[model samples]
Target: MELKQETQTYEMPHLLTYYECDETGHPSMSMLLSMISMASDEHSMALGMGIEKVQATGGTWVVSGYEGQLAEQQPVFGETIILGTRAVAYNRFFAVREFWITDKEHNIEYARIKAIFVFMNLKTRRMESIPAALIEPFRSPIVKRIPRLKRPQKLNENAPIVEKDYRVRYFDLDANHHVNNARYFDWLLDPLGRNFLKTHRLKKFNLQYLQEVRDGEKIDSKVNKLIENQKITCHQISSDNQIDAIAEIEWY
Candidate 1:
């Protein structure tokens, strides 16, 4: 079926807090992703598809991947920003959602991101068809083909790469009983070190999740050493002898 030109949207105002920001006093990439995620949950709740309702179908929504661009000028702690999201389109197995963060007046966009989500069976821990009762309330069109996001480039394994290992902690899990999608950003970028992160700002990023990272797992995050003239970096996260996720980021 063809989707409508207009889709349901939801927006809310959020006040940035000190904890959400880094040393630059601006919201960090991980926290920025979390804010938009919060908006998505609120959107679902407004449509009467809260966690309880969705979980009743024996499955929950999982973010498969995200692609986004960040404005050079970002919102700082103590600033009020608007978080907005819309149900773009969906198929039986995948749904695309768009999100944005802007000043309260909506004059300047701080970040714009699009995420692809899949319904996953909690018990089986595998992909499942999205139930109509959980998704139809948003009124997004059902399409035979859901548009795919740009894929991130893979890293050169033989190249000089920096790697850091982190153990999955209890706090990393969200209500879905899986690692929170936003936490991956911290692992992906941390290998770049403090100096680089403080000096550069992210312009664009694409993150693809190839496998799930479970609790107590010791995961290795690796990134190619930055080239002097190149502003792009490739990252990979691996655990249990498998590549769990990969990301490509462009910096300013």
Candidate 2:
């Protein structure tokens, strides 16, 4: 495919709010993910591919995984931050996008993340080829070799694991009509408990979503209780004997 209009990057400003922050006064991981996701949505809308437009083709965009790094210093509530994203590349089966959170001046970057997305058939819930209308505007080079994100480490079952169960709630559903991917971070991190979450800062993470988590299903979120001296922890989300997602988090 020949390249066309290529305004690949899109950026917007967001005012941090109290509700998005945790006890430590920084935006929670899940909210951080959500904010970047909003940027991506805005990017698509700017290119005339809104959710309704995309869904009209009988499919929707879904994130398959994310890998990101965070700085020790984070923006606090009441501050204005910049959310930026760009379509990196795409292939017939997948698309890659990069995102960043920074101060308004772009001097202090709080986080840098990348996600792999796939087109899924809404009715059949199966993978599909990327629609040229949905992807061509970004002008990301269509390559046979799409980049792959780092695979998260598998949970060590032999190690001491902390497990918590949660019921999928109606509120968890987003515009895609499934549990929002960002909400999974809440379930994944809550098992770390309050004190630990307050004291530690997440430095890096990789999360892979293997299956869709639907509303009304009972799910288990588990994390290794024994953190490596390296300050790394492994997590898993599962339901009905199947693993739904897995992640590895590195903390400072």
Candidate 3:
């Protein structure tokens, strides 16, 4: 019943509805995260660890952190895409998973993500060791030896950089009622503008959430291009500059 590292490939049909683009029409960041979630579900189902089975075991998977970067040109709506995922590695408390969004033609990679996950005892809301049965199916040895990603940089209190404002909306709240974690990506990346967004696909990403964003509040987003390789971005939902989230993205 020990969990194993595994890899799975899935074909994701492009849904036009997901292209709720911004002022510049393209796939939105929120929709990209949603598609990644769907791909994760499909990967789990393929390994026979679908939601029903996890619920039956009285435990569930929870995302701890995620890092992803966007490629400049995302496939427009109605384009067929392929989403692939693999169980990279895991330790006692943390599991690492990798995913990619690619064109159906296999010529381009639109996005890539690395995420950390933890198992929770649904009743107690406490972290639990992942069961062997749940992981064995993944069949990935990469998880065993994979190194931890670097933590994102913190903002300096003395040299503060103020950025644009993001207003929370009703739909931004998920079942948990806080701002949906993925929405932060919009605030984090939008400052770069359409040109930067269109020219580069996310080659690597590292993110950490320090706090939460609530409904109806205005949040500020800041970015620092520390070296071309390390792009640091942060989000705070207050004028006082308390960080609600932070992300580091690397472009290819």
Candidate 4:
């Protein structure tokens, strides 16, 4: 399949707000995801397929999963950065979106991400085919190509070290009353610590959601660094032992 260059580019100006930073004085993983969401909206608007047009078709784009890698920990409160995004490709049921963050000079890439999106019928609340009119403006090919993202592989439980815990927070709930999907990225990546996080940038990531997290319920996050380029993480909510999500992130 022929991969076409992006027809349009969306540039987003980001002001690092204090509330978005973590204890280490850098943007939190959750906040980074928020910035990506903002950039994705701007990209859609540039293509003339803003939120209204998406909803007019009785469907909306829902992020199925994301993979992000950061080169350095972004600073807090005073940095002005540009978030750029482009629509990469789309099939009947899925679409691929790409994003990058660069300093004001645009010389260095602070972070990069690839995401999978699916359209859902607002009324029926089920996955639906992506609308042609909505995708055509992006001008990316509807090719057979799909990203070869790494999948989470099982790890040895008897290993020398492993970490796991459950989380329950009121703020995790979104307007939809379920946990906002992006919050899971925080839980998935936080275990890597500020040391490893500050030193490496994400090269690739793949995530999958299996269940929903509810308000007031505890969710367990399990993580293991299985190899040099791979890490496996999972989220389980409550005593039912239900796995809500799993993700694999690769770093350089």
Listed in order, each prediction's TM-score against the native is 0.96, 0.96, 0.72, 0.78
Task: Give lDDT tens digits, candidate 1, residues 100-180.
Answer: 999988899989999999999989989999998888888888999988989999998889989999999999998777788
Show how many residue pairs clash in every candidate, following the order shown. 0, 0, 28, 3
| Candidate 3 TM-score versus the reference | 0.72
Candidate 2 per-residue lDDT, tens place, 28-95, comes to: 99999999999999888888899999999999999999999999999999999999998999999999
* Candidate scoring better on lDDT of 2 and 4: 2
Give the Å shift of residue 30 in candidate 1: 1.3
Once model 1 is optimally superposed onto the true structure by TM-score, how far is the C-alpha of residue 193 displaced, in angstroms?
0.3
* Candidate 3 regions with alpha-carbon error over 4 angstroms: 1-7, 16-18, 142-145, 163-170, 175-179, 187-204, 210-243, 250-252
lDDT of 3 at 188: 83
lDDT of 3 by residue, 1-252 (tens): 112332334445455453455444556766777678777777788678888798687887777778776677777766677776777778777778887778877689888888887887877767898877887677655345546666775655455454678788999887644567788888888777666676655556677766557788888877643334434444333424677777766665
Local distance difference test values of all predictions, in order: 0.90, 0.91, 0.68, 0.70
